[model samples]
Structure formats: structure tokens, C-alpha cells
Target: MVSRKTLAGAVAVVGLLVSAQGANALSIKEALAATYQNNPTLNASRAQLRATDEGVPQALAGWRPTITASGRYGYSWENQRGTYFEHANYAASISVTQPLFRGFRTVNSTRQAESIVRAQREDLRVAEQNALFQAATSYMDVIRDTALVSLRRSDLKFQEEQVRASKDRFNVGEGTRTDVSQAESGRARAQSALNTSLANLNTSRAIFRQVIGIDPKNLSARTNVTSLLPKTVSSAISIGQEEHPSIQSSLFMVDAAQFAVKTAQGVLLPSADLLGEASLTDSNATGNLGPESRSATIYGRVTIPIYQSGSEYSAVRQAKEDLGRTEILVDVSRDSIRAQAISSWGQLNASIASITAAEAQVAAARLALEGVIEEQRVGQRTTLDVLDTQSDLVDARVTLVTAQRDRVVAAYQVLSSIGRLDYDNLGLSGARYDPTEHYRLVRDKWIGLRTPDGR
Candidate 1:
């Protein structure tokens, strides 16, 4: 019992391997907001998603017209029937080609690009959830470590008082040498334990800073996300399997791969294009000049593929196999998400029970410690007995502190495992980042050198 709190706090501190701002310890929502706004991982993922946004326009390019201009000039000297002549020739042409048909490759390729964009958006969602989870865990760890340090200090103070009382009684010839020695030894150990707890608190504070982008202050710790979770574990699993971003992303990948197979198969079909061209040519000699000539023409072109070494067939087969892989991955993601929901649900229930048990144990230990101290004063108990009881009280209080932290952390885990731990779900205050805004801005874009935000 004396060692349990020390072990729990020590473990949490070691894991902290990163706090809070303002008057009160930051609430879970506020910390989540901070992470959402400033975390590098989340921001980078958003940027990556934005890059994916351009794929739609690129795919749509297959349906657009291509225009080109060319100009050529040449000079020549020739002798004809004893007469020397110098001639110069120049030509200029402009042409435009609009795709009339492309075996439906453009349509399928565009659909595939759109599907990839959707998948990347889900990837962004996963990043957001991960950052928020880290922030919440770090916040709770700081609170637990801080409470353990306070309890350690109080226990140290109690031990110091015991040492002084034992010394006074021994000077008055009432307490034995063994009692004084035990009291002094217990006081030393308590001091050492307090130092260890302080170190743990410092470690937890460092981790808090790393995750939440701030140092820990007097972080208050009262909020849990139980309301965001489903009422039953099975419900949680069902929700997770349905709503988790990993599953959604993988499903979108299946869609993209299906479209890709079609796009590749389209390669074997004929393509048609309508083209228009205009040209002007002029010729001049050293002593003779010719009138400039102008010409214009419009034409329709078709390209029929007649088996070029089976590359397109290979591509079609490869795309079909990739589609199969993506479909299997969808099941993989769903299975992982289901497991996560069940494990988080179990942890939440266990934490709730532990908290209740720890509270009762703390109350009983405090009463026992008081009784032991009074008995020591009345010559019915020894200094060592009082030290032992006080240690038990501190351990009980530490257990309660750790259990409370666990309860809050477990609630958030349940929320995350079910794919409900996000800015909107938590109802965080601030401007939410809308990925669709970027996707819409870039999807149909024809020409641009800079981003929508002018960057």
C-alpha cells in the first residue's frame, strides 16, 4: 500500500518523457483547442490535405482544350540559269485542340481524384483526434502528479512532527532510544519520498508543455468526457466501426481504386479530339518579293490503340489488384477500431470502480492514522506505529488521486475510440478549421499561381 502511489505516479511521470495557462487549470476543451490550433503535426496534416485538393483540377485537365503557337524563319541562297537569287521564308501558326472524347478516362480519373481528396480529409481528422488525445492525457498526468507531490509534502511534515515529539519525550525520560531512532529514520524516508514526488511533478510538467504547447501552472482538473461516449460498450463499438476516420479513409481508398481500374481500362479505347489551326507564310528575295499567304483549317482527330505490347492490359490488372487490397484494408481498419472501443470501454468502467474504492480507503486510512497518533501520545502506541499509519494514509490519498485521473483519462479514451473526440463534439470555442473550404476552392480551379489565401 505504501508503494502503490509512488509506482503509479512514477509510471505516469516516466511516460511524460511535455501545461496550463490562465487562472484555473485549463479545462479539457480549452487544452484541446490549443492543440488543434497550434500543434505542428495537425497543421502539417492539414497542409498535406490541401495539397491533395489540387488533384481534382489536375484530373479534370483531361477534358480541357490545349493551345499552342509556333513561328519559324529561314534564309537561303540559290543560283538559277546564271542569275543569283536570295530568298527568305517565315511561317507562323496557332492551333487549339479540344478533347471531344477520351474513352471516358477523364470522367473516371476525376472521380478517382475526388475520392482521394475525401480520403485525405479523413486523414486530417485522424491527426486532429491524435493531437487532442495527447493534450488531454498530458493535462491529466500533470494533475495527478501535482496531487501526489502535495500528499508527499504533507506526509513529510507529519513525520517531522513525530520526530520532534519523540525527541522531546526521550529527553523527559518517557520515550526509549528505539522510538527516537524509528521516528528519525521514518522522517528521513518521508523527506526522500517527498523529493521523489517533486521530481515526478517536474517531469509531468515538462511533458505537459510538449503536448499542450505551454508549461503547467496550477492546472485545475475536474472535467471528464463521459457525456460524449455511448452508454454501452456494444454501442460504442458499433459507432466506432461506422464513424472512425481510419475506416472511412480506407473505404474511400476502395472507391478511388475502383475508379482507377476504370481509368486504366479506358486506355485501351480510342480517343477523339477536335482541332482548329491558322497559319501565315511570306517569302522574299534580294530583288523579288512575293505576296504573304494566309490559311485556316479545322479538323477532327482520332487515335485508335492497336495493342502496344500489353502495357495497358498490365495496368488494368494492377489497378484491379490494388482495388482488392484497399477493400481488405477497410475491414482491417474496422476491426482495429472495434477493438479500441472495447478496450477503452473496459478501462473506463475499471477506473470508475477504482475511484470509488480509493475514496473509501482514503477515509478509513485517515481515521486509522488519527487513532494511531493519539494512542502514541497516550503511551499506548509507539512512534514507529504512528509513522506506519501516516504512511498508509498518504498511500491511500495517492491512490485516490491517481484513480481520479484515471477516470477522466478513461472517459476521453472512450470518446476517442468511438471517433467522437473532436473539436465539434467537444464543443470547443474558437474558429473551427473547415477542410471543405479548401477543397471547394481548388477543385474546379483552371489557373492560379498562388493559394486561395494568397500564400
Candidate 2:
């Protein structure tokens, strides 16, 4: 039979293994920071925001003067009255046009661009939150699966010893062959469970790498975000409606669409501009006639739209329709964010409750298993009873691990739902991403081929 001291030694070894793993653990904050800095999807969103920033300068360009320069040179030969003649002419001119009025198109277009940029900034925030949440989920999954694998392996070891004990008893006629066969079956099942747990651990690790841009290394147990969550679901939904990135982005979109309607309306109005031109021309004649001339002129011009095949009117109607759509989308975004907040809040609460229940279950199962083992030693319980109790203990440990993981992941989900899963709120230490800096750099910039950082 397996000695009690041997079983205790095995348990101590497993505890030491767990302790060693904890000693080199990575914190959730460090994982989130790595994800924020390296996640491909989040970085792509940042790049997209930078692209949107150019719209402001494009709209502002409408207010600036346009200058054009042209030069032409030509040689010609002609026969007149049976006499051959050759002439060469060269001309160069520069023209400038500055818009004095464009029916407020520039103003409305600039406003629209500004609103769109702000919307894109919110979009980036959404991406950041999503990436961080995914990273946190994957991190917790790894931890959970790793613990389950360890538990399964330990269970398998105990079952292997049980099988040996049963065989030794049967050889001495103290136990039946049925007891040996049952122990062997239990050991095989434990091995299968361990294999499954290992496979799950590998899958979780792959997800961790994909989300965080690095393989998980000694990940520590993550602290629950209960301290960061709102006290009530109603409060969470309220915060979500007010601060969620999706809702904020949609609100900005509505503003942009409204300005778009104004810009489209401006297209129907007259445009006025100041125009100036300067030119130089040189001409040579074969009959000893050559001349050079220079001229400069400045004038104000107005262009009144008379007919455009109803295109301008159609554009105005389209803009109005778009405005209506955007206004409706704002409400849609609000509803979706609110729903997410409520669902996540419920999940967080459920997981917390589950953790508490699982803890109690683990304690009860541990005591039951110890009682069964002692009863078996006293010949009051069969070997199968002891094996069954050990299996129950392993199952209880697995449930506890899963509940812990769920609690951590659900907490992050709640934060994400309310739009608080960000570096600032989490107090993560790193270079904070600021979209406004790029916008300010390019908003009023008249001319630049390079970005703010010279990229």
C-alpha cells in the first residue's frame, strides 16, 4: 500500500513546484503594457488615425491661394510668296488665385474634418481597450490551464501509486483483482485528463502570444478588478453611455455629418476669388522683325453656379440623409454600449460568486478525500472509494482554477464595457499614446512633406 508519508511528500513537492512558478511570475500590468506597445491591431488603428489627421489639412487647403506657372517654346518655318521664313517664340506666365469667398465651404469643411479626426481618436481608444482586454483574457486563460495541467499530473501520479498498491494487495490476496483493475482504470483516466489539460494550456499560450506579441513567461495570478468596477450595474451602464468609445465616436460622426450637410449646401452658392497674372513673351521673325513683351494683370472674379445637371442638389440631399443616418447611429451605439456594460457587469458578479462557491467546494472535497483515505486504511472504505474521492478532489481543484480565471477575465470585460480598460485608468506605466499631439501638429500646418516626428 502507498504510505501516508509518501503521499504527503508528493503533495509537498507539488507545492514547491507551484511556489517556484510563482517566484518568476509576470504581472498583469506588465502584460498589458507589452500588449499596448506591440499589438498589431492596436498599432494599425494608430496608423489609421494618423491617416485621418490629414483630412484637416486637406480641408484647410481650401482657404489658401493656388499658384500655377507655365512655360512654352516652339519653332516654326513657313513659306510665303515663294520665300522661306523661320520664326521662334517663347512664352512664360505665372498666375495666382485666392478665394475671397466660397460660400463658407471652407469653414464647414474644416469643421467636418475636425469632427472626423476626433471620431478617429475615439476609434483608436476603442481598439486600445479591445486589445488590452484580449491580452488580459489570454493571460488568465494561460494561468488557469497551467494550474489545471499541474493538478491533473499530480492526480495521475497519485492514481499510479494507487494502482501499484492495489496490485500489491491482490498479490497477497488482501484485495481482489477488481480493485487493481479499477485503480489502473483511474490512472489511465487521469493520464487522459492530464493530456487534455496540456493541450488546452498550449492553445491558451498561443492565444497569449498572438494578443500580447510575446509568449507568456511565468505569468503571476492576476488581481481582480473589483476595486475598479462600479458598485452598481445601473452606474456601470450610465458610465458606459457617457464614456464608451463607441458612443463618443458616433457622437462625433453626427457632428461631422451635420457639417457635411452645410458644406454640401455651400456648393450651391456663388464663389468669389482674387486672380493675378504676369507673363513674358519673346518672338523672332525671319524678315528682321523681332519683339519682346511683358505684362501683369490683377482682377477679382466671381463664379455663379447656374446649372449642374442637379448634381449639387443631389449632393445636398445625400448629405442630409447621411446626417440623419449618423444621428440614428448615435442612439444605436449608445444602446449597444449599454447592453455590453450590463452583460459584463452580470458576468463579473457571477464569476465572483462562482469563485466563492468553488473555494468552498475545494475545501469540502479535500476533507472528504482525506477522510476516505483514512477510512480505507482502517478497512472501512474500499480502494475504489479512495480513488473516487481523489478524483473528486482533483475535479474540485480544476473548478476552482477555472473560477479564478473567469473572475479575472470578467473583471477586465467589465472595465472594457464601461470604456475604462485603458492605461490611464489601470495606472499602467509606459509611454501614453496621444492622438491629439499629431492632430495639433498638422491641423494648421500649411506645408509639410514630413510628419511631426519626421516620418
Candidate 3:
């Protein structure tokens, strides 16, 4: 049987091969995974999640036994009627205390901390999704730019062919000076378009490289345009609402606030605990004596609060208010997520339609340009008309390429909104790097608590 580490390494190699073909080739999924693992913003969110984990221990401290130790030394001398005496004393003791009652403060506090941890975990998830979504968008842009460059180069070839034909016709005295001028102008414009497209392609590739942690300059690949859009808007909305990280994170916030109220209630309740201590002491002086003996005392304490000048009451009320406010926030988040789902769904559909329309436009423009060129050869079309048709063809091609790229990006955005833009969904081929992993490792040691999920 293959070991897990070996399998992971193999998968990583395969992933590299998948994105390293042709010129400036990279898959959107691979780029997303790289961004998810390395983006600074996502890493920061992971840190915040670990910080929230400390709340657990802070709350637990209220319930655990408290121990304290102290030591003291004293020296004294007296002289009277030609007699002098000196004495010294030393004492050390340890004390232990356990809370017997506190208005349910410990219980409420622990629960509140748990809720906050949950909220922060969801927040981490949301951040990861956003990072991956950004990477996907940038990846699609690079692909589109690369394709448009190729298209522009092909158009330039056609322009060169037209120029050659115009020259041959002029040599036979069958074409006018204006016809040659028109062909030459068309060729020049096509070259300019190709140069611009190449520049845009390079910029887009650089952005993808920064996002995916891999250079995408020598790989050229095309995507299937028809598969860019989802089949149903209703399904997209439903899925997005269920998986969207922001909404889930907000839901956890409500849980945390409610727990805060519970913690406040704990402040007024009774609690139970056991405590023990040890001590040693020595004294060289005693009352009216020349010598003294050492002694030690150890004790435990139980504290019960009856009044606090209304501070406890205010704390409880404030906690309740916070809980109520968070509940409202949850409601607001739900509405906002629903609205976002609907909006993203519509935009995805519109982008898909635009892509189709743009493709049709490119095809029509190409045909029109060809027809005008033929008419120019026959002295039936003006030089300006031929030039205009060539420009239209180039613009249409570029527009179609951009529209297709946008459709792909929009599809990924819809998935991200639903909270599904995770490593598994992206189909990354290596060990998933969770930025929270290190934080989780140290959370227990730093906070003195068990994992909330018991993992």
C-alpha cells in the first residue's frame, strides 16, 4: 500500500502537469487552491480564529481552583539593664480557593466563548472562499487575453494576404491606387491590434502568476465556453445561500452573543470546587521568651457575593442587549445573503448570454470583412469601407473573448457566494494547506482548554 505522504507528492506533481502546457496555460481551479493556501488576507483570518480560541480558557479559569503562596521574614533587637537580645522570624504559607457561588458567571462565560469560537471559524471559511474566488477571476482573465492574442495574430495574417492580392491586381493595372492604400491601412491596423493584445495578455498572465504562485507564460489552452454558466438560477441561489461563508459566519455570531448572556447569568449562580495547600514557618523570637518555634498554617476559602453596587446587574443586562443586537444582525445577514444570491445568479445568466451574442457578432463581422475585401478587389467597395470592416472584425473578436472570460468568472463567483469554494471543490491534487492548522495546534497549549470540536 502507498503511504499517504507518497500519494500526496504524486498528486502534487500531477497538478503541476495539468496547468503547465502550451503557452500561458493554467487551470482556474489550480490557481484558486494556490491562492487559498497563500493569500495574506486568508492567513490573517486564520490568526483571528486562533485568538478567539483563547476565550475558552479564560472562561474556564473562573471554574478551576486558584492557588497562592507567600513567604515573610522579620528581625528585631532589644537592650535593657545591660542585657541585649536579638531575634528573627520567618514564615511561608500556601492558600487555595474555589468558587462556591457566583450567579452562574462561569457557566455563561464558557458558553459564550464557545459561540464566539464557532463564529470565528465560519469567518475563516468565508475568507478562504473569497481568496479562491479572486484567484479564479484572475485566472480566467489570463486565459481570455491569451486567446484574443491568438485571434489577433490570425486576423493579421488575413490582412497580409489581402495586401499581397491588392499588389498583384495593381501590377496587372486592374486595381486603383486607392485599393492598395486601403489594403495597406488594414494591414497596419491589424498589426497594431495584435501588439496591443499581446501586451494585455502578458499583463494578465503576470497577475495569474502572482495569484497562483506559478508562472503561466508558456502554456496556451482554451476553455469550453458553453459550460461556463449554470443551468438553473433557482438552484444556484439555493446552493449559494446554503454554502455562502459570510452568512454562515454571521449565524455563528448570533450564537456567540446569546452565550454571552448565558455567561452573565452564571455570575449570579452558585458553583462548587475543591482546593488544598501546604506551608512552613520558623521563628526565633516569642513573647517574653529567649527562643521561638517554627509553625505553618494552610487554609481554603469560599467566596459568595451578595451585592456589587449594581455592577453585576448592569453586566447581565448589557450581555442580554448584545445578544439581542446580534440576533438582529443575523436576520440582516440572512436577508443580505439572499439578495446577493439573487443578484449573482442574474449576473451569471446575463454574462452567459452576452458571451453567446458576442460570438455571433464576431462571426458576422468576419464574414462582412471578407465580403468587403472581395468587393474592393472588384472596384465595387471604397477604401474607407474596407478599412472600417476590418476594424469592426477585430473589435468583435476581442469583445467575444472578454465576454467568454467574464462568464467563467461569474460562474465561480456564484459558487463562492454559496461557501463552496473550498479545496475539495476546486479539485486541488495535493495536501490541502489550511492556514488555521498551526493556530489550532497551539490553541490548547496557550489557552489550557480542550478543542471545541474535540478533534
Which candidate's lDDT is highest?
A: 2
Better of 1 and 2 by lDDT: 2
> Where does model 3 exceed 4 Å of error?
1-25, 73-89, 151-203, 217-231, 269-277, 283-306, 433-455
Better of 1 and 2 by TM-score: 2
Q: Which candidate ranks first by TM-score, i.e. highest?
A: 2
Model 2: per-residue lDDT, tens digit, 1-455? 55666555434422321233565678888899999999999999999999999999999999999999999999888898999888898999999999999999999999999999999999999999999999999988887787777678778888888998888878888889889889999999999998998999899999999999988998776464678999899999999998999999999999999999999999889999999999999989886767899999999999999989999999999999999999999989998998899888888788779878877887787678778877876788898898888877777677677777787788899999999999899988779888888888888898779898888
Tell me how candidate 2 scores on lDDT.
0.86
Residue 168 miss distance in model 2 (angstroms) = 1.0
Q: Residue-wise lDDT of candidate 3 within 62-137, one digit each (tens)?
A: 7666778898898878787878767776777777877655567776677777777777877878777777777777
Per-candidate clashes, comma-separated? 8, 0, 30
Which of 1 and 3 is ahead in TM-score?
1
Per-model TM-score versus the true fold: 0.87, 0.93, 0.77
lDDT of each: 0.83, 0.86, 0.67
What's the residue-level lDDT of 381 in candidate 2? Answer: 88
Candidate 1 lDDT at 408 equals 82
